[model samples]
Target: MSPTLSPSPFGTAKTLVLKVGSAVLTNADGDLDKGMLRTIADWTSERMAAGCNVILVTSGAVAAGRSALGVRDRNLTISQKQALAAVGQSRLMQIYAELFATHGFHVGQMLLTAGDMEDRRRYVNARYTLEELLRRRCIPIINENDTVTVDELKFGDNDGLAARVAVKMQADALVLLSDVDGVFSANPKTTPDARLIEVIEKVTPALIEQLCPTSQTGSLVGSGGMLSKLRAARLATSAGTHVAIANGKRPGILSNLVAGKFVGTYFPPAPTHRSQRTQWILHGRVSGTRQVVVDDGARDALLHRHKSLLPAGILRVVGTFKAGDLVDIVDSAGRLLGRGIVNYSSAEMDLIRGHRSADIAKILGAKPYDEAIHRDNLALFEEVTSAR
Candidate 1:
């Protein structure tokens, strides 16, 4: 649904997952945005008064660390970044506590790693903790655990994290507050004819290929780009959560979206929600013991037809895995297609690559099934990315 400057766009959202990117939290000078932080605290309190529950996912700890340590270089190594996050997280929370406390509300901190959301038990525990925090009229402020998260554990940006939280919490809406206004056909700064796409009913790979090539990852202070936000939208909207991407730098942008003022790009939720297992399979760290590389035909079948992955489409397997383990499916170009449980071991798949499904028994002398990965066990992203 498109908002026409009316209050109906997000007016009915009882619980909202709001993510503030580093672009809004860190100033151009790489310092904390004092004024913006204060404004958001007040805005959040006001929303609560009107009976809206908000789960705030934020980014800025590393930037805060940079400011405290007086380091301006953006090329810091993984270890350096972790060290800075360790120092800055405390300061960031302190500032937030003071700001929110002034409004007669308390705040709770939640530092999460990719593993927290990927594991079922940890995910449920996190949700229960958040529920209690909100029940006590406190805001839950969440951030990725950057201090010890390196390599595959890192979220790279908070956009994906917010979407995962929104899905897990079954939030009514999600607002991504960033520096940009919304999604566009191309880079508006460079393309004279680029136009804003106000309503995105569904995010598709074709749309991504058309609009995302020129998207810059982020400014020095932020880690996500237009493509990242779009990918996040694809994940959330597919799982029955509404989403909006707006310019947080603009005054009252969040309120405008909440009030249905039509200030950003909006995506309506899917007609039906996917099963919990589907959500778990689709939205994790995008991990598997290995990535199963597929031919173009196989990628098409999995993505477009929702068909089973067959031995005919297999190209090469990138990692080792036992049967019944999740494995990433990628095209030859290394773009992520999806992930699913593999019926055959990595060694078995390597032997059967590029062969017909009917020949599986002849080649291996044992055929568990004709399909390598069944459609029921696979989940494909509507938009493709080089994320993993």
Candidate 2:
């Protein structure tokens, strides 16, 4: 379904996920931008007074670490970075606690790693904790657990982390606060004719490629740039969450954006589905295993409409996957058809390969069912792809 572009239904949204980029929250020397944080806190407090639930995903642990260590070196070891994060996290929370308390608002710190989201049970638990905190009228401040997260398990940036948080909580909107005003037709400073994209109705693959080139890099303090922000917007919007990319430096921008003032680049919400199950299958989790090759019939059944994957249509299964594991469905030529949760382990499926539904019990000794991957557990990855 095509998403529609329009101003947000003002003051109606209950929950908002605000992502503050490192560049906006930290200086070139990797010091925290105290004034900017105060502005954000004050604005968030006003929104909370208006009965809005605000969840902040902030990036600055590394920057704060650098500042604490008085290190101006561009190339710091991973251990050094982790040490900095450990030292700076407490100081960062102290600043936030002070700022929010001054406004008579209670704040809670939540540190997350990729592992938290990768496991389904842990993900649900984390969501419950955040929801309870919001229910108690306490703002949840989230940051990557940099002290424990190495390169592999890290989210790589706050933009991606915030998007995951929005998806997890089923948030109403995602506001990405960055240094720039919004998405531009071209590099704003270099291209004089470049204009700001006011509204993005749909985030297409072409748009993703344009905003995020393959070699694009981020600032020393920041990890992702407009590319990551665009991907985050696409992810959130597809899950029926409205997104806005705006300048954090602008005073009162958060309030303006939330009020549907058309402050920056606004991405409209996708069609909302009543069933969270369908939504989760369509967009919630990423596939864990590699591609699963199927025949054209299987591809048509899945893409054209909702249909359960049958073993008869299965061609090949790549990757070592377990029962109930998420795997990508691909065509005979290796194009991604969609993603679905397998009912049988890879080993079992290998033995049952190309077998009829009637012979499943004989092949595997026991059968979950005729279908290898059920339709209910499958999610399609058809949205904009990250150029990164």
Highest TM-score, which number? Answer: 2
lDDT of 2 at 368: 66
Off by more than 4 A, model 2: 1-11, 151-155, 272-275, 282-289, 381-388
How many residue pairs clash (N, CA or C atoms closer than 3 angstroms) in each of the candidate models, in the order given? Answer: 0, 1
Q: Looking at candidate 1, what is the lDDT of residue 134?
A: 94
Q: Candidate 2 deviates by what RMSD?
A: 4.0
What is the lDDT, from 0 to 100, of the residue 312 in candidate 1?
Answer: 89
lDDT, candidates in the order shown: 0.82, 0.77
Instruction: Return the TM-score for each candidate structure.
Output: 0.81, 0.89
**Tens digits of lDDT, candidate 1, 9-115:** 46678898989988899888989998989988888888887888988898888888989999989888888989888998999999899999998889999999887
**How far in Å is the alpha carbon of 183 misplaced in model 1?**
1.4
Instruction: Report lDDT (Cα) of residue 245, candidate 2.
Output: 90
